[model samples]
Target: LAEKSNSVVDNDSKRKIKDKGCIPGLPIDGLPVYTGKEVAEHQDPDKSVWIIFKAGVYDVTDFIQIHPGGRELLLGAGNSVEPFWKVYSQHHNQQVYRILESYRIGNLREEDRLKEDRTQDEMESLEFIPERDPLLLVHHEKPFNAETPANLLIQNYHTPNNIFFVRNHLSVPKVEEEDYSLEIEGIGLDRTYEFTLEEIKTLFPKHTVTSVIQCGGNRRNDLNKVEMVKGISWQLGAIGNTRWTGARLVDVLRYCNADLEHPEIKHVQFEGLDLDAKSEPYGASVSSVKAFDPLAEFLLAYEMNDEELPADHGYPIRLIAPGIVGARNVKWLAKIILADHESQSHWQQNDYKSFPSNKKQASPEEFAQAHAIQEMPIQSAICLPEDDQIVQIKWKRIDDQTKPFLDVAGYAWSGGGRSVIRVDVSIDGGKTWFDTELEQETPTKRSTTTFSWTLWKSEIPLDFNQLRNTGNQIEVICRAIDSSYNMQPARNEEIWNFRGLLNNSWHRINIKVV
Candidate 1:
């Protein structure tokens, strides 16, 4: 068999292989080379198959069993780069190869590369058990915390109940809605007011507004290069725009006998249903100016996107404060307290606050001096056609057949009700710029805007032959100019911080031509 294989290979060198004629030794059958996009797509269980990866390293540790189809198929490849990778694409980065070295299966034998029947033991003990695919978002192949992508953000008025990004510190609690009661207390009041969900909803004027909620660390993933941060590697999707309708928090404060306009009060405290490892619940505090400002539009929302809040996004009742970091949108609303000082919950006192741009986990005393992450910074990201795609088109064909290989689109928003005044897109790494048309859907006030984050777009014209001729490389970047005309820094290094928060540099992507 060795002699036969040697002879076939030796013979093939004598003949030139054409695009269509190479069968047994065809690229797909021989070894696969995959782009990041292709790997993400094939990770789908129903459609995923064993493709021979090129002889190299591959990091499969994190992807092991979360595979919806199971792990055996991948484990079956053993350590050889042949059979499976024959269909998988090869990564080009040395860093990626270095990481993959930790998970290599083993070397392969030519004969073992042939297909074999599965044994009963191998078939029966499918330990994967067909449970839910643990990778919440298909692309990342990991649990959904904060790091999910922006474009992956569901495109409804409110994020779809199922896909709303989850940023849980502990497992979600299964509190019965009927048993739930909201407790409100003000430092000046003699007693706390406990109201059932029904009572709160019926008591206040039902108000609804579509607003975007983002985690303060929405772009923390981009900050890891400077120094390690201590929290979730949330991407832009930590934000979701939803129509929240329910009782105004102001009204609730009024019922608690709290003053509407007062100088003594400084902060409003909120507690969630989540508990720490020791069973202590989580809570946070926002300033009185942020919480009670008529324009802030805070709410004890019973409905998200016109429906009861789903369990993942704070079922039954959740505090919905538009234009603030999601950490303040405490899920499973439990308590609201008015005080001269901030809430004493661990989240308020420790976790959610931001350190000095120069500090790490500051001491408690140092933290006392630090400020909490209230509103998010100006930011944007491209959602469609993704980061890298090999698009085939003729420059002439581009006119009507295919939109320019490069179409820029994404969302942009600012903190403190600051509207995004302009958004710019550049296909050549910002060498040249073009202003994109903003899609304004509703009337935007200083606090509320018809455009939450202005979704902007632009197009580039390229002929197919040119794309194929150019080796298919193009860079796309986007930047937002807010009401203050403060543009995101072009590079991340200038704004690097210890907690990896607010790294909103111009987002860029590169794609190949096919």
Candidate 2:
């Protein structure tokens, strides 16, 4: 049989050999070299499904049925799998290689291989807009995270979209208006309800809420000074106030027949359309009580400050969990689940949690026991005269009196619907204090439901004699009192954590009195 197989083969024999498998010795190194166009033709799963990994092509039609991640996730079926594999790193292991080796058909053409390699590199490169405002201080460029300068934050009552602090975990996904849809599911519902962009607008009554969204690590830089901590060194600019217009989350849940009162529903998990390298969606969760409370003012916002939601700020839809940490306000919203447990996303379980101040080096067990930060504590920061800034003071000697004054300004806010009742400022570093005029743009001044931040300013009567004697350095300190009588701690050491989160200590800034 071996001798007979070695004989000169006819067209029928050659066809059989090719159909069964590769022959022992054949031209083109025992595998046919398919053109780039020919490889693209097999993209359809129903037909011949082919994918390229490295420089080799594989026919994965049979393997698609048994793919653990599902066949729909095989996005590179018609093209190179390098991009998908780069994100889903699990494929880079040896076990996956063994599985793929069985389906290997041929090597990709050299030109196509080089083109795909270049395309993969481009996809992995971090992308950011070059026209970003100069006022924004970039913390990271890959994910395009930045914060507004403290001085610019007080320029207006409502923060402009361009200068708003951006805290992104993944690339901003570009979603088409016509193709956008929101999915609702979980144990509290009988079935899933998919809502198109138009249906979301027409089916519910539009409601607007002027609220403040603050990152959990708003004043992390202050904490970092006391002790080195993990996370972006965000100053006081991580918070922003805006008017969000959309349907109430409670109304939407009820419209979808969600059993908000169901005993099994403890949390509402939100998934964003923005995907990570692993193809997993960015996600977070809020307590079911907060999500379902009509007074909580939660929103599925489509508009920001009367304008259509900008692409940087979640485009068509984003969740606004007022009075909660900004991380819970999931943007570019895609799916919502009424779950018994909190979201299993990395941001929910691992990050955004505060540990004990004494636990300098936290272990995995300690982090697991620590509760995630939801509602922030009393917080305030001086925005006008930034830290280490030199201010020019005007001194006048009129008649028989010498008078000097300085204008101080900043913002204060508290979580869980608490209003900042008063803000106290001291130029002598907490020795002497004076009250500042508090200004807020909320619906009711008496209402404790202060979802917006309070902007406070005061003109302090400075003692020229004392200022001249203080070696030209003045330490200014500010602390806030909430409606509940909660005040920021005197020092960061009191509230310091490994993650540098929720740093609401009395914000201090030293200025040179020039």
Candidate 3:
């Protein structure tokens, strides 16, 4: 017992064992909590093909192979299908939800339900689910969070409005364009100001800025491999680049006689129209260092990708704070507050801040001391030659020698408007590396103002003669360097955290060069 127990699940152990982890369901209302062990105990196909999803435990023995996907549906017989839903979004529709509800025998326990599959406790804040593209992998419904596919993510410089990644904290607010209003008040303002959508657009000159908005939790899945982190198992798709057309936030604040740099103002809070069960709207803030910086390029954006903003993306209006984490770019922006301190919302105070990896639980005092996440760290990912893919080789026969190779491509970016200067690609993993050509949508500009992402692609030459010496597989890797010379950490454990925010580790994927 002095040496070690049979096993442990601390961060160190989880790091050595990198596995795809799932967030267990939490009890809603006063429902019972059932562990995975209990769910597994009921997994006899002849009796009940039990399944766990979100927090629901279902018995589908009567349905059997009658499912539309046939045996494919049984693949998740004894486990949670949350992972499967990441790539298979077709089954996330109302019909599927209803069918699963009919078979529900109980709930998947976290602390954890249930006469009802979900109740007001779980969805009182939710309005209605909006229709999303089947290609966009869904992480949560109701609020409707989803991400783009890796391949499609880089196909366009400005992601299409339809397929753009969404990270809504609550249901899309119902606000008609004519009645939409933005209220401004708090410490720095001379007086409270309220303006309609028309006044906001007509009163100020419209400006456009091409920028990238990425969820702070974008690469959380990578962190989960090291140790299970709490949050959506979001992969690399929770990011998008686009042109935002709106009035400059600086101009609007000045008009209200409250410049962000005012002596009394230390932070700028943005609140959303969508609210929680307690009627507390989604809220976040940026310090004056960011809010007051001219290079910050904060905007009261009404248009996305040159079109009117979609409802799922805060239609009437939203805050587009370049170089900052997406959470601070509040959607369905309802109010702007110039305050002496940061926003006092749950998201601002407790959730978004990064914590030490070793601490499994945090005290309230620890959360209060942590600063809000503003700038993102330098990062990159490999989209082409997906993990475990059978890579097809290409070569020039000028010398009659079959020199095979693989083409790799992906995106890179850094926060605080730091442009991605270079992307290093590797064919034999980190043992070798080569720089790739980068393509930027916006005109080349200063590193501190270049808020968009850089798409990089390269043809990594393969060593045909030595291809089969080690094995039939090739490990594709990428690490980006920002203009500030900040490079992504080489290993996930180097920056592992409990919340899994800001995981900008070197993105690596293994593929077969058969």
Candidate 4:
């Protein structure tokens, strides 16, 4: 035996010391530290992979049974980065970096070393299957999965309570409407008042606004394929257009009985029920100008799609700031604070800011140097028959509403209150174009236009007898021009980011002409 050393292993001390020439033990740092890539490989066979993310030092032991995949996959790796980062990237924080540095010996791979070049054929031969992820709302009980389609979303005025997507950063508290009360803090007497849902209905003048709440990460999947990016793999469905009915937040601000001339007030803060790893609640803010603007269309919405709000969707009350990213739509009526400073929550001070293509995981000091992403860009998508298909087509006249026919429709909206002006549809391979019969007007401010999706129907021009004899291919393409004249980028590479977000490419569908 050569020697003995001391190292911390899973909170227990292990003793081992190694010498140079055939000695006993090596230092704790000499142990092979597993990376995210390694954890993924180990769990691929049986998903019960428990990887202790070396960075966050998180106690994921309890989450094993609750994991959607299975406990087996969450138990595979110990003290590793793969499973944790892969599943919890959105929850990553500064503390995680500190934990990683404490254990890292050095860079596992040397940058100067070069390996044999991979041929194009070799790279092309590799098979990759993307993981489907659940949607993470700032605060909710469960993250809603994204396999739903538009017709289903529009089946009713309001999405089903259970079917409604859940985006939460913390556990859903059992809040009772009768026992609930809203507290308004800032420049006036701090007061807590309670009201019944029915009392709120009769007390305040009811207003209705059709609005679309879209996630900032709506098209991020497209961004990710171009390059490694941060954030969620949100599909296009991160957006939903719904009718919101409530009292204007501006009205509430006035009712709070604050002095209008208060000079110290600079920002309006909104807090959600979401909590951090340390049980800190997530919060964010907007400028007092934006929050109090008469025309901002911000609402303390109590009803969605004309029904009682669902539990998954903030339940009794939630803030609805149309045209703003989903994060600002704080769920679970908590507290609204007017402050001389911005929100102190982790999300407001740390995340949701965009960076240049070259930056990655910059420090808070560095991020503050960049601008926050307040408004989303122009984007559109086709919800009819996706990219490839075999389908039964029933042709009918546009004037005949009674007949069922193949209808091509989709949703389009732009950030900063821009409206979709025109949508062009091409069914004959884009060789020629036809202006879709679009709705003549835009929806309410910050509201998603449902009928404007340009659900076009064309009678298969009875003149294709000759072409029908031979196998034919039908290619459909759709694009939108927004009020600001901004259009979707022609390719994904143009807007690629390290963190996959904002993937708005022209949606096309190809079908066999059966």
By TM-score, the best candidate is 3
TM-score, one value per model: 0.68, 0.76, 0.77, 0.66
Tell me, by lDDT, which candidate is best: 2
- Candidate 4 error regions (>4 Å): 1-147, 150-163, 187-202, 260-263, 392-407, 426-433, 439-475, 508-513
Per-residue accuracy of model 1 over 1-514 as CA lDDT, tens digit each? 1111101222233232222121222232222233323333334333332223332223353444443223434543323333222112112122223333333222222333332213323423432221222434432211125334555553543555455566654445666768999998876566889999899889889988677777766766667656656455566667666678889988887777777566777888888876543456678888988888766788888887788777667767888877777778898888888889987765565556655567543555655566777777788776654666765532435336634545556777776667888888776667777877786446544534432556676666544565565667767678898887778889776676655667789877677755
**What is the per-residue lDDT of model 3 for residues 1-514, given as tens digits with 9 covering 90 to 100?**
1012112224442332222122223323333345677766656666667777777666677665565334455667777765444324334443455556555454566443342234434544445556678899887874578999899988998889888998876667778888788999998666899999999889999999998999998988888888776677789999999999999998888888885556878888899998754467889998877777766789999999889988888878999999889888899999998888889887888678888878754566677787779888897988886777887787755477766667899999898888888899976658889979999855545544688999999988888555787576777789999878998889889888877789898998987776
TM-score of decoy 4? 0.66
User: Model 3, stretches more than 4 Å misplaced?
Assistant: 1-126, 259-261, 397-402, 442-448
The digit string of per-residue lDDT tens for model 4 on 1-514 reads 1011121233221121111112211124434343434433434223333243322222233444433223333444443443233323563433334333333221122211111113323532442222222422322112323423544443443344444544554445556777776667886435644445565567778988766677777766566656656555665557766778888887776776765457888887887654433455667787777777666677888998888876657767788876677777888767788789888765665566766666545654655565555666776766665556665666565565434334566666666566777777666555665665544335655544332222232333422553375355566677778877998766677766544455666656666544
**Cα RMSD (Å) per model?**
14.9, 12.9, 11.8, 13.2
Better of 1 and 4 by lDDT: 1
TM-score of 2: 0.76
Native-referenced Cα lDDT, model 3: 0.76
The per-prediction tally of clashing pairs is 29, 0, 4, 29
